[model samples]
Target: MWLNAILGPVSSPVIWVPASDTRKAWSSNARSSAATHREVFCSQGIFGGFMLGVKSISGMAFSFYDWEQLELIRRIEIQPRHVFWSESGNLVCLASDEAYYVLKYNPDVVARARETNASVTEDGIEDAFEVVGEVNETVKTGLWIGDCFIYTNSLNRISYYVGGEIVTISHLDHTMYILGYVAKENR
Candidate 1:
């Protein structure tokens, strides 16, 4: 299935363009949060052919965009203080004030939605995530290594987490942020 894309000026409405064939593309008069152009949040979906976190009146809005139903923005009900996604876009870590969750986006849902040529229901997109792995700690910032999550916390501790379990732990002299990871050097 060809993954469609949402385009057009942020101030106006959104245009859903089929990346493969612009001729079949259609536009929507409905407003999207993208119109606000808020920074410090929002990431394009890397693995799932969707968009990640976006800010909404409800704090943070999570939605999925696909080719079949290009107009509807079915939202998942969850607000996180911060969001960290993987390079390939398959994995995401959502952080709140007290805990963080690691979610693996399931591509099968997108495939099924395309096959049926139906709009993916809200529950469909929500079920697209593997059971979220939660850890009871406040994360300041984080990065992703494959399915693993590496982060620095409010306690000034650097921890490597696999499925939300601490695999290795270390302390930082001062609070430091994890910019990114180099897969080649494994730094």
Candidate 2:
């Protein structure tokens, strides 16, 4: 489901909702007094992954779930923080200024649990990130960098192609970015 909100002084306020019935409750924010405020807190839980806290204000707070439970594992009093899943299902939280935290899960355990499991196939070689080039394709997608390759959709032009190479380029148009190369496998 998709949601959009516009806040401002208008003649008539309009609320739009999807047709589907699936819905979840979210926290709300309010002001208590001139010097105090009430904030609605939220978090995201990706099954078999991590839990990340979602706050309303910028540069206010960030959190990660405990390794065992998808609950608030650690909370940091910071500002302008963002959290999301990396390429490998790892929880990544970006905190104050330029600070970042990356977490990963055990692949062996995950693979064995699936009913139809197969050998884990790595996209490319171990050092696949070292190759430099340009983005040959521009997917309206996201990327992440972990113990391996990380793709970022918001990372603007010069970005990494998950399971591919890293390129230093002139410009990242729909075609010019060389994601990865077809070289001999050295595993």
User: Best by TM-score, which number?
Assistant: 1
| Candidate 2 segments whose C-alpha is farther than 4 A from its true place | 1-24, 27-49, 56-58, 66-71, 91-141, 145-155, 161-170, 173-187
Question: For model 1, what is the alpha-carbon lDDT of residue 89?
Answer: 66
Worst 10 residues of 2 by lDDT: 30-39
Q: lDDT per residue, candidate 2, 124-179, as tens digits?
A: 11211121222333333333445333333323454433333455333444433224
What would you estimate as the lDDT of candidate 2?
A: 0.33
Off by over 4 Å in 1: 1-50, 66-74, 117-119, 122-126
TM-score of each model, in listed order? 0.64, 0.35
- The C-alpha lDDT values of all candidates are 0.58, 0.33
**What TM-score should be assigned to candidate 2?**
0.35
For every model in order, what is the number of clashing pairs? 2, 15
In model 2, the Cα lDDT at residue 21 comes to 27
lDDT by residue (34-93, candidate 1, tens digit) is 322332223322112334334344445555444343433335555667777676767777
Model 2 clashing-pair count: 15
